[model samples]
Target chain A: MTLTKRIIPCLDVKNGRVVKGLNFESIKDAGDPVELAAKYSNEGADELVFLDITASDEQRATIKELVRKVASVINIPFTVGGGVKSIDDARNILLNGADKVGVNTAAIKNPPIITELMTLFGRQCIVVAIDAKRNYDLKENVNIFSENEKKFWFEVFIFGGKQGTGIDAIFWAKEAEKLGAGEILLTSIDADGTKNGYDVLLTKSIVDNACIPVIASGGCGKPDDMVEIFEKSNVDAALAASIFHYETHGVKGVKSFLKEKKIPVRL
Target chain B: MVSVAIFDYGAGNIFSLKNSLEQAGASVDVITSFDKPNIYSGLLLPGVGNFDPAIKSINENSKTKFQDFVEEDTPVLGICLGMEMFFEKSEEGIEKGFNVIDGEIVVLPSTMKVPHMGWNNLEIKKPGTILEGVDDGSWVYFIHSYRAKPKFDDVITAESDYGVKVPAVVEKNNFFGTQFHPEKSGDIGKIMIQNFLNVCKK
Candidate 1:
C-alpha cells in the first residue's frame, strides 16, 4: 500500500532538441534533451519520458542518438515514444538505452502490435500512449466512473492528436491492457499544455477501467495540480512538461511539496 | 578490481545497467553464455522480458554451465525477471526456473496493480552485504508483476509493501536476487551496486 507516487517530466523532442507546446502545438524549444534528462534524473524525477515529435523517417537516427545520449547520462527509467511505428523501431530505441518504448499511432493502427511487442520484449517494456480528448457527443454507457461531473466522454486520438479516432478512451484502455500493454500513458489533450490541471475525470476513468498502472499526463501546472490528480485518481504516476520545462517548479520541488501534503513520493 | 559478467538473454535494455555498474567501479562484460563463469568474481542476471523466453534462452544455451557457475560460490545476482527465474517455477510462465533458491514466484495480489510498477521503500529484513550503506527504508525502483516467495524467510534480505510483503531482495550462500532494479534506482541503487562489488571483492 506504500507504493510511492511517481513524478515524471516529459521531454518532447523535435530534431534532437527538447520542445514544448500548448495543446500539442505552437512548439517552443526547451533545451537539449540529454542535459534536461540528466537534470531531471538528478532532481528526483521518478522517471523520464522522451517523446520524438518528429514524424519524418529521416530523423530516426536523431531519435536513436538522442536516446543513447540521454540514457548514458541518466540512471532512472527512461521511456521513449513519438515516432515509434513498429516492433523494430521499438527494439532500436530500447537497444539504444530506453527502458520502455511508447507507441501511440502504431498501436491504434494495429492493436496486435502491443501484444507483439510484449511477447517479443516483455509486458514491462511496452507502454501504450493514448492521446485523448473529451467527446461531448457519446452517451454514457459505463456507469463505473459516472460520478464525475464531466459533460464529455473521453475519445482516443492518434497521429500526435491530429486525427481523432473517435474511439472511447476508457474502453480502449481496457483493450490495450488485454492486448498486453504493461502500462498506460494517458495524456488528456483537452488539458494538455493548458496548465489548468489534469483531467482527473479522464484519468480516473481509465484507472477504474484498466488494471495496469496508469501515468496521468497533460495540464500539470504546479505541485498542487499533481496533488489534486493523485488524490482524485489511482494513477501510479503523473507526467508534466510545461511546469518542469519552464522551471515553474522543479521535480525535487514538486516532490517536496507533495511530501509536505502527505503524498507518498520518493524524496 | 571487481569483475562482473552480465548474462545476455538477448532481451531487455542492458546499456543503463552496464553504465551503472561501470559507474560503481566495476569492470563489466556482457556474456552470451555462462561459459567459464569462474573467471569473473561476480555474475549478474539482469532483468527484462518474460520468464519463458528468458528461461528458454538461458536453458537452451547455458543451463548446465550456469548451474556449475552457481555452485562455484561466486557471487551471482539476479534482477527483476532475472530474480523470478531463480525460483522453482513462476505463475507467469510454465517453464521451471533454475531453482537456486527454494521458492515459487506468484503473481501479486489482485488488490494491487498488476505490474506493481513504481518506487517503493524497502524494509530490510536481515543484515546482508547487498544492503550495505543503504538506509533500511530507502526507496528503490520496482517494475514487476510476479515476485518470489522463498520457502525460508532467512533468504529475504528486504521486503517492499504492495498490499503484501513482496520480497525485494533475496540471498542464499553466494546467490543474490533483487526484485527491484538496482541499476535504475538513483543514489541508493548506486550504493547497493557498490556493495555488491565489495562482496565480489571479498
Candidate 2:
C-alpha cells in the first residue's frame, strides 16, 4: 500500500507541557508533554505531532528538551513544528529524533524554504502546514469567491491564521506541492477549535487539487468526525489536539470507532 | 530467546513493527543486510512506498540471502508492499517480484478509489498457525491499492472485502504474508504478531 490513513494526535506544547485553547483563546496547560505522549502512544496513536505554539525566542531550549523527552519514550514517528524558521532549527529537531519537521510561517515568508529543506533532507522530511479560513461574502451569503474581478476571495492567512495574505488557499496548496513539500497539513481556521466538524468543503478542495497527501486538522470533537473526514474529504490523515489531550477521545477509542465505521485507522 | 529478523529496506514502518513484535515475546533484530539470516528463529519482510524501488533494494542487497533462508521453511511474514514483493510481478511499474508465490499483483479498479485506505473485514480461507487466534471475519486495518492474485486460491489464509476479495493474510507452510499493517492494527494486530512468534517457537 502506498499511503495509509494516519491517526495522529496533536500536542500543542507551551513551556514543555500539553495545552489547549478554545478558538485560540483561554489557553490552559493540560499535562506534561512526555507523560501525555506516552499515554497517547499506549492508546494507539499512529503518530504524534508536537506543535511548539509558544513564541520562538522564549522557548527554544525548552522546546528542544521537550522534543527530546517525547522522542525518548514514543517509538512511533513524531513531528515537531511551529516557529521553525531555519535549517539549523530543523536540524536540531530532527537530531532530537523528530521523524518530520513541519514548516508554516517560514514557508509562507520564503517559499523556497520547502525546497531547501527537501533538497537537504529528502522530500519525506518536510511538511508544509497551511492554516486557512474560509472567506464568505456577507453580501452574497455564500462561500464562493471571484478572483479576476478582485471581489469575493477565499484568501489564505499566515502567522497562526491571524494575518490574511489575500492568497487563495487552493493556489498555495498547489504551489506548496510544486515546491517539493512531502505533505500538507491543512487546517481550517473557520472550523478550528469549534469542535463542530472539519471544514469538509475546504479540505476537499485542497485534497482534490493536490496529488500529495493532505492531513485534515481542526474541528474534530469526536471519533466519528474523523470517519467523516476520511470518508468524504479523500484526505489521508486526521489530526486533533484537544479531543485527544483532554481525554475526550483516546487514540484506541478513536481507532476502534473508525474501524467500526470502516474508516481504516491504525488500531 | 525467540530471535526475529525484521527486514528493513528503509521504506517500511520498522520502528512500530519492531515494538509490536518485541512486545509479543520475541527478540527482534532490524536487519538491512542479508549476510546473516540464521541468527533469527523467523524472518519478517516489512515494506512501505512504491514496489519498484523496494524490489530493487531487496534484490540488490538481500535477495540471494533471503532465497537461501526461505529454503529451510522458516516462518516469514510480509506486510503490505512486502507481501506484494513475494508475487512473481506487480502491475505497478510492471516490476518482477521474488517469484516465491506463483501470483501477480494487480491494481484495484480505479472506480473504487486507488489507495483503498482504512479498515475492512477478513474472511479466513484456511486456518493455520499464523492466524492462530484471529477470528475469521475480524476487522483489520488495510492500506493498499494493488493486491496479489495468487495462482492458487488455497494459499490465501484470509481475505477482506473492499469491492473485491482482497487478501488480508496468506500462508503456505512457513511462508506467510499480510496485506494490512499488523503493527498499526492495535490489540488484534498485536495478537496476530504473537501468533507468528508462537509459530517460531514450534
Candidate 3:
C-alpha cells in the first residue's frame, strides 16, 4: 500500500490554553490551541490530538470552543479528548469540529460506551485512548510481556493515567476493538515524560495484536526516537508532546528526518 | 462569490470540510436535506457516518432532487461514504445506492486492516477534474473499510494500491468523488479543493 506513516502532535490543554502537564498549574502557558494547531498542520504534521487534563466539569465548555477555534484554523485531522464521559460529551466535541472523539476513563469505567459511541458516530470517529502502565506485580491469567528479565503485564490506567485498573492493556485493546472502537491510542505510562524513546516492545505487541490502527504515544524525545519506533513497530502513527510543545523540532523537520530514514511520512 | 452546499449526513464531520472549502475561496452552506431548493452552485456529499443511515437520510427527504443534480451535471463531489453512496450497492449496508455509478461497494480484503486509514499516494490514471495540477503519487488522507468497484474502470481517474487497486479519485462528467477526505489530506488536498471550487465558479 502507498499509505504513509503519520506523525501526530499531542497538545495538553486546560482552560483554553495549552499546558505542560496537569500538576504544573503554575507552569507558563505553552501556546494557544488554535495557533499551535495551525502551525502543526502547516508544518506537515499528519494529524493532531488535544488532551484536556482539566478535572472540573464547569470549564469543559471552553474546551469545545477551543476545539472550534482550532478546527477553523487547521485543515488536517484532529482527535479531542477532554474526559469524554458520555455520548453527549463526544457529540459536543464532534459537533464542535473535532474529527474523532477519544475516550479513555469512560471506556474503562463503562466498556459498553465504546459500542454506543461507535453506533452513534461511525467507527471511524471513535478513538479508545488506552493509557497503560507496566505493572510488575505479575498477576495470573493476564497477557504478560517482559523486558530485561522483568516479567510484567501492561495494566490499563484511568483518571488520566493516575489509577490502575487490573485490566490488561493488550486484552483491553482487543476488547475495545470488538466493542466497536475505530482506533486505539496506546500510551505507555512508564515511557511518557521520560523523553528517552518509545516503548517499542509494548507498542509493537499492541500493534501486532490489534487489527485496527494503533497510535504509539509517550516517550518521544527527539526525531531519532520517532525513527526508532517506526523502524521497530507496525503502528500506523506516533504521537509526541514535549518535542513539539517545547519547540525541540517542527513537524516538518521531523517528517524530513523520517523521510530520510526511509520511513514514509506526509512530507 | 461561488457557493457550495455540503450535504450533512449529521455525522459531525462537516466542520473541517466547511473550513477547507472556505479556505479554498468558496462560501459554504450546510444542508441536511435536499428537499429544499438547491441554491448553491456546487453540492458536496461529505464522508461521515454509517452507510445505511446516510443513504436513509438522503432517500428520506430528497432522493429525486439529488438524482437530478447528478443527472443534469450541476458539479457534485462526494467524499468517502459520500462517494460510496452513489454506487449501485454496498457490502456495508443493504440499502441500494444512488445508482449514479455502475459499481458496488465491497469490503477491503481481509489481508489488510478493516479501515484503510491514513495518507496514501494517488496513482493518477488519466488526470483532470479534482486531480488537476496534483502530482502523481501525491498523498491523500482516507478512512474507510469499503471500496467501490465500478463496472467501468475508465471512470476511476486515480487509484491506490492497498493489496487491491483501490479507486482513490473518480470523475464522471460533472460528478466527482474521492475515497479519501481532501479536507484532511493536508496541502495537496487544498489544491484539489481549490480545483473543485474552480469548477463551481464556472
Candidate 4:
C-alpha cells in the first residue's frame, strides 16, 4: 500500500551549525542541529535528515555525535549523511541511532558501496543522495554542457555540488537503485535555493524511472510546492532546508496543506 | 498478560514489528530462541533479506519449538519473508518450509518489477476475524519479490493487485500471514494488527 510520507525538513550542518545555500555555496548559519531537529520533531515532522556539508574526514566524529544527540530527543526516523565514505562510517551512524545512512560521493566513486552497505545493514538502511543540475545547450543534439554554459538542462554533480560528473541524472538514479539503494534522495542544483519550487520535471524523470522511494529536494518555497510534487511527481517525500529553517513553514503547516490537497500525510 | 513473542532470527524488521505490536497494546517479547513458545499469547515470524539464509537460521534456532507451537493451536503471524516461509517450498532455495500452509513460494513474473515496493489497496476476499475493521480498499505497504501461491484459494483473506492477485493476507485457523508490512502501513496497519490481537484473545 502506498501511504504518503509526511514532510521532511533537512538541515545542512557544517562545523555544528545549520546552513543553507544554492548548490552548497553562499552558506549562512541556520542554527544548532539538535535544536532545529527538536523543533521540527515537536512540530510533527515525520522525519529529519542531517547532511554535514563539509568534505573534511575529521568531521566524522562530530557528525556521529550530532546524530546521537538528535536521535536522543527526536522519536521519528532520522537519516545522517555527508562525509560518509565507508561501511564503518555507515555502521557507526546506525549504531548512533540513525535509522538510515545517506551516501552521495562515496556511492558515485564506488558503486559497490550500496551493495556492501545493504549486505551489512540491510537494504532499508541505505539511501543514495543525488545532487543534480540542469544541463542545457542552444546547439542541436547536445544534452549536456560544461559549468560555463548559459543554458543547461540538469547535469549530475558531486562533491557537495561543486564538481560536475557529466553523467546523466536519470542514468545515475537508475544505476543507484540497481546497486541496491533502498531509496534515492534527489536534490536539484537548479532549485537548491530559489524557493520557486522543486524541479518537477527533473523529479519526475528520476521518480518515474526508479522503483525506490525518491525524495524531492531543493527549490521549496511554500507548501504548494510540496503539493505539486506529491500531486504531479512520484516523489514520496518533499525535503527542504530553508523553509523549515527560516520558519516559513512548519511540518504541521505542510501536512495540513497536503492533507487539504487530498494528499495523505500523518497528522 | 497479552505477551506476543516475536521470533527474531536477525533477518527482518523485528524492531518495527515489535514497536507496532506494542503500540497495539500487546506486550511484545522478542524471542531469539524458540525454546518456549507456550509462554506468549501469540507469535510473529517477521523476515527480511535472502531466503536460504533465513530458512537455515530459523531451522537452526527455533523450528522444532515453532512447529510444536503451531500444533498446539497457538496463534502465529508471519510477514513478508515470514509468509513465504510458511509455504511448502521456495524456488529461491531448495529447502522446504514449515508446511503450515499448502502453497509454494515462487519468484514473481518478470513482467512486473522484481521487488514490489509501494502502497497498494487490499482486496478482501474472505473477511476473517483478524481483518474485522479493515475496509476492503484500505492500502498496505509491501516490499518483496517472492510470493506464496496457495493451492487453496479460500486460504486467501485479502489480495492486492500487482499485475496478479498477490495475497495480501492469508489465514488457516490460528496461523495467519500478511504479505504487506502492517507495521509500516500507518493507522490502517495498526488497525489490522489490533484485529489480529483480537484473534489471539479468543
Specify the highest-DockQ model's number: 1
Expressed as tens digits, the lDDT of each residue in A93-199 for candidate 3 is: 99889989999999888999999888777899999999888899998989888778989999998888778899998899999999998899988888887788998
lDDT tens readout by residue for model 4, A1-267 = 334554789999988889887756898888999999889877877678899887577754788788777765655667889988898888778766676789998998999989988766557668899999876634343344445446665667888888987777888888898888988899988888898999888898888888777889999999988888888976788898888888787788878888898897766
- Lowest summed lDDT over 10 consecutive residues: which window, candidate 2 chain A? A138-147
After superposition, which runs of candidate 3 have C-alpha atoms over 4 Å from their true positions? A22-28, B63-65
TM-score of each: 0.96, 0.75, 0.96, 0.77
**Cα deviation in Å at residue B86, candidate 1?**
1.5
Q: Write candidate 3's Cα lDDT for B69-108 as tens digits.
A: 5456578999999899879999998998888889899999
C-alpha RMSD for every candidate: 1.9, 5.6, 1.7, 4.6
Ranking by TM-score: 3, 1, 4, 2
Whole-model lDDT values for every prediction: 0.88, 0.77, 0.88, 0.78
- After aligning candidate 2 to the native by TM-score, how far in Å is the CA of A130 from where it should be? 3.2
Candidate 4 — which residues are off by over 4 angstroms? A1-22, A25-80, A91-100, A120-125, A134-155, A162-167, A208-213, A227-237, A244-267, B23-27, B35-38, B62-65, B90-95, B106-114, B198-202
TM-score (2 decimals) of chain A in model 3 = 0.96
Model 2 / residue B152 / CA error / Å:
2.2
